[model samples]
Target: MSNTPQKPVIGISCGDLNGIGLELIIKTFSDSRLLELCTPVIFASNKVVNFYRKSITEINFNYQSTKEYNRLNNKQVNVFNCWEEEVAVNPGQLEDAAGKYAVLSLQTAVAALKQQQIDGLVTAPIHKKNIQSPDFNFPGHTPYLKSFFEAKDVVMMMCAGSFRVALVTEHVPVKDIAKYITKENIVSKLHIVHKSLQRDFGIDKPRIAVLGLNPHAGDEGLIGNEEETIIKPAIKEAKNSNMLVVGPFSADAFFARKHYDKFDAVLAMYHDQGLIPFKALASGDGVNYTAGLPVVRTSPDHGVAFDIAGKDKADASSFLTAIYECIDIIQQRADYDLNRSNPLKKINPEVFARMEDEDIRE
Candidate 1:
């Protein structure tokens, strides 16, 4: 076998042709420095790529158009045409055509991921409303991937640097948030978060903080019973399992006090409770990672900005960050699995001898 380390093949799914998905993808790959890290395969047609490239005249985006994956160029960006038919390219439009094609790109990219054609996936943002259909009925990519991979559960984690916030309930209404805040669900999410922190992030012992559902963390049951009944019990269960888990802290005070910096990750109760703070604190470099799945998947933290669809004003920082995170996680998982397979390979002979000497002395 060759000893040379191969660059990972990263699959990109053009989220919505009408949105800023193409714009972001083009801009991100325009940086030649990124090409040295991994090979990129974009799941869209050459015509659509040209359409977006024409609009963004400032960027000199170059790509190789290919229908076959085996002939991909590692030194250049590859556009894998999912469909050859001409489609309307209406920027900032909420038509069904754009949504239909968005689903197709996602499905194609996901199929490649399942077949091991790609090492990891970095998805652009997709509008939740227009992308809905009979075949693709999930609220967002996280749930859709969960069903596609048949994973029992997955955590939607927002990461920027060391600040990571995970959601317990995603895309659900505020009124129904309490019903989903059960001990079982909380424990399950905590388990996923803990494992992801260690495996995906390369942290041996991770510290996690859990947020409360209501104000003041239910004020010890004066405001709501969830913190006392549901959250506290869940924290206790996670702790008993010998995990470094803490809190049922008040979301407002915890963030205001900057308590999130102390833990490796935080688990929030609902959507806004986690994402609202994450978007503000992440400084536009946030990445959405789906943890606990068999396959690695990540996306830019923002949605498809229809208002700035064709405009060259959208920043590619978050998109670039997502791609970097996907590559890093792929490598991290490989190292983690290798160490697990041969635990003795990681132990030093000196350390083993020292332990034996100490035992003899005792």
Candidate 2:
């Protein structure tokens, strides 16, 4: 929104205090290459960070607390301490205090993003169940951020190098996905995915592939009518919208030899449908990016490994990818603004008019 030419200061949301989030941030901030790309600011406690670094061998970073970001022109990691009540954290353990701290960090980073202090946020993993205390009752970071930014019609995309996959329905049961699939949801997701491919990833015109819910794509409706009854109508709508979207293709046949190269992204019906192939390809380096968020947001595609939290064995590949993606997205988003056409003329009213409740089941 501002015409400032300064490099984006990425706000890092330290996930669980005891989890690998702290370790990942510490490792990333220590890298000289990462520090040069963008200003790194951690919304966490300095004490907790130091405690985790001691358990590891190679930890070289200058962590300092700061309330004013303008005064943080120095080339050191800045910490925004949001810890309300101090509590000792033990690695490899799930404590309520750690959960509370995770949430507090998220809240602070979000506020900084709102104030235009940070260009984007790269979040560390947080235990979902532990963080839903009295103050926070939302789902994982995506939904919670949607509510925070008052944004709708966003999608979750996982990327590792060239592999990019977006989920149509996230954090929902597989059975419920069939019932929720509609022309509106699919079209909305298609538009965001298409725009992101072009606007965020710098693909001028992107080809997108849509996956099916049933095996063999319901065998042309013999195995199940959902392929024709629900998904087809949605694909038709997306195609009419000028989105380069293809298929209700069988997920089995879709990920075959160089299948992903044909399209920029594949829209899956649910989490496992997309993640199964994505994780298989990306492995430990998968990065989960929240597409269509008001501010750029990404996270490592793995969970809080409570078993190996304190063992100093957690791989930080995904963490590095998350930070790199955040920087990439922010830069792309900025460049896109300069080169993009007038988006007001591109917004399709028909896409939004399709009611989400209008589910077809014939």
Candidate 3:
């Protein structure tokens, strides 16, 4: 860690102004520990930021916008206003301007990421179909960014403190889940999840649990054959590569305390398989992370929460966690890259092999 270079810069994608995105952003950045870890910048409108602050806090922002990170800028919140549009910009009010502002914020943040101005990104939740213009017709943030960056390895992993789950298929219907479930898709997500645990979470050997598509792991092939056909081959291949991969565990039993403690990350077959428990335990505190991107990207797990917007009741725990996770990922990635440069000096293979054997023995 001491040998690793550079503090992470966090770029926040401002979501819908009508949603609680602004409130959470304002509240989370108010913490001083956040400033110590990374330089926080907002890709949003000054007007929306100001409106939310005054409405929620009942006062002007204690900080001001700046161009760079410095001792003086540390206490202030900096914003890069992307859209120059003017509208009422009221909280709890859904308008096309609010939707447009969301896109502009993401565009500016993505540009900054590509230009190397920021180390990572933490996006606020945006209303997917609402942001529907001829230009911005993507389903959700993960797919939208995946398409724009042309990322083959891009996968969505949701986090709440220590619990992390990666999705094989996201934002698709339950019926379509069967159609999209394939050997290639399963293998790809498994690889991404394994790499993310090693790179982002600093886990030298990640124990990955692959959840099943049907009840009781398809009741031994009577209910479904995805377990026998698609999943088993992928697990066998991963183990042959010296990866600690396991299961087509029933999603219901796996979330139990006795079961989940065994693995580093759970690979869900579809959206609801992973998210049902994620949203249940973490709820407002869950954070969504996009694994396998060239840069780190995370966001609050929950949606816009338009119903509670301007009520000053939105929780900022997930937003703070997202920011903190970005910092940790950046630091970890730096160490991973540095270690790669000096691979000859890495930990001895005998020692690693012995440790792997010890873990297996346990």
Candidate 4:
């Protein structure tokens, strides 16, 4: 039997069809080299894909349309049709129909993920406002996924190379942000980040830095007491559990001084506190990864660019990076699980003692 590993089947969710989702997908997978890395299954109809393919005349995107995973073509891009009805494609326009289809694509892809039909998922950008409905009403993908998988909590982590920033609270209003910044919440995120670093990113010991909610970390309780009361207690609790966690660092000085380079990841208090600096430092190639989920999921950091939808002005760097990160995480998780499974057999103390005795005799 061949020992070579089979390519992972990566599920792709078509986000906001009228937006730049299809354009980015077509451009990124148009390169045949990416096919060698993993098999891609796009969750959308063939008609929708052809609609966007006509707009971008520069590259040819050939794909196989199928409804069955058992009959998937591993060497070619597979378009798993979520809906067959002919939908109108308006490139820069926002319509309720587009949102409906986006939800369809997401639901289908997530179903496949739950069934283990796909190894990992790479979602394209979705307009948060348009994609909201009775069935799918969440701020973004992070919360929706957390609800779907029944995870107690999930961290919204932004990644660019080794520079990572996870949000303690995401998609909450500024006024409500302080109420959610409890010591228990911070400690939960720390535990999630710590496990994700080890299992997903292949880090043995990850150093995490936590940013404060208030200005100058509450100026040591003069400005606000979140750092001294909530954040400090949380850090202490995480440290007690043997996690390499530190800080209540002032957000402004941390990024300004490039102090992020010293840690494996940073935990920000809210959405903007972490994302603003992450987007700036990531330089258009950042990926949003939902950490602490049973299944691995990643997406392009940017949103649905309605301004550049049909003009072919969309950059595929971040989307491509998301796909690569998804594949890498799947592999890392497999390696981590294999190493930890049956640990007693992996390290035999008797053999180690015999080897040490032989070396001592010599």
Name every residue pair that clashes in candidate 4: none
lDDT minimum window of 10 residues, candidate 1: 1-10
State model 4's lDDT.
0.91
Give the worst 10-residue stretch by lDDT in candidate 3. 66-75
State in Å the error of residue 151, model 3: 1.0
Q: Estimate each model's TM-score.
A: 0.94, 0.91, 0.89, 0.94
Indicate whether candidate 1 or candidate 3 has the larger TM-score: 1
lDDT of 4 by residue, 1-362 (tens): 01123589999999998899999999999999989999999999999999989889779789999999998998999999999999998988888899889989998999999998998999987888888888888888888899999999899999999999999999898989999999999999999999999999999999999999998999979998889989999999999999999899999999999999999999999999999999999999999999999998999999888999999999999999999999899888886786687354245668646766777423
TM-score of 4: 0.94
Give the number of the best model, judged by TM-score. 1
Per-model CA lDDT versus the true structure: 0.91, 0.84, 0.81, 0.91
lDDT of 1 by residue, 1-362 (tens): 01122588999999988999999999999998889999999999999989988888778789999999889999999999999999999989888889889889999999999998888899988888888888889888999999999999999999998999999999998889888989999999999999999999988999999999989998879998988888999999999998999998999999999999899999999999999999999999999999999989999999888898887778889999999999898888887786787574366767756766777423
How do all the candidates rank in terms of lDDT, highest first?
4, 1, 2, 3
Model 2 C-alpha lDDT per residue in residues 1-362, reported as the tens digit of each score: 25333567889999998899998888777787676788888998777877888877877777778777776654778888776355798888888888888998999999989888888899999998889977799779998898899997689999987679999889887668787777778888988999888878998878998988888999988898877988889888888888888889889778866588877888998899889888988878999998887689999999888888888788888999899898898888776785444343234545423432353211
C-alpha RMSD between model 1 and the true structure: 4.2
Writing each residue's lDDT as its tens digit, candidate 3 over 1-362 gives 12343656678988987888989998887666667677678888677787777777543445565444342253456787675567576677778878887888888888788777777889998887678899988888887888778889678998876778899999998878998888888888888888889888889999999999998889889989999998898888888878898998988988865476777888999898899887887766788999988777899888889889988999888888888888888888887876677563266768656866777423
Backbone clash total for model 3 is 0
All candidates: CA RMSD (Å): 4.2, 9.2, 6.0, 4.2
203 Cα displacement, candidate 2 (Å): 1.0
Find the candidate with the highest lDDT and give its number: 4
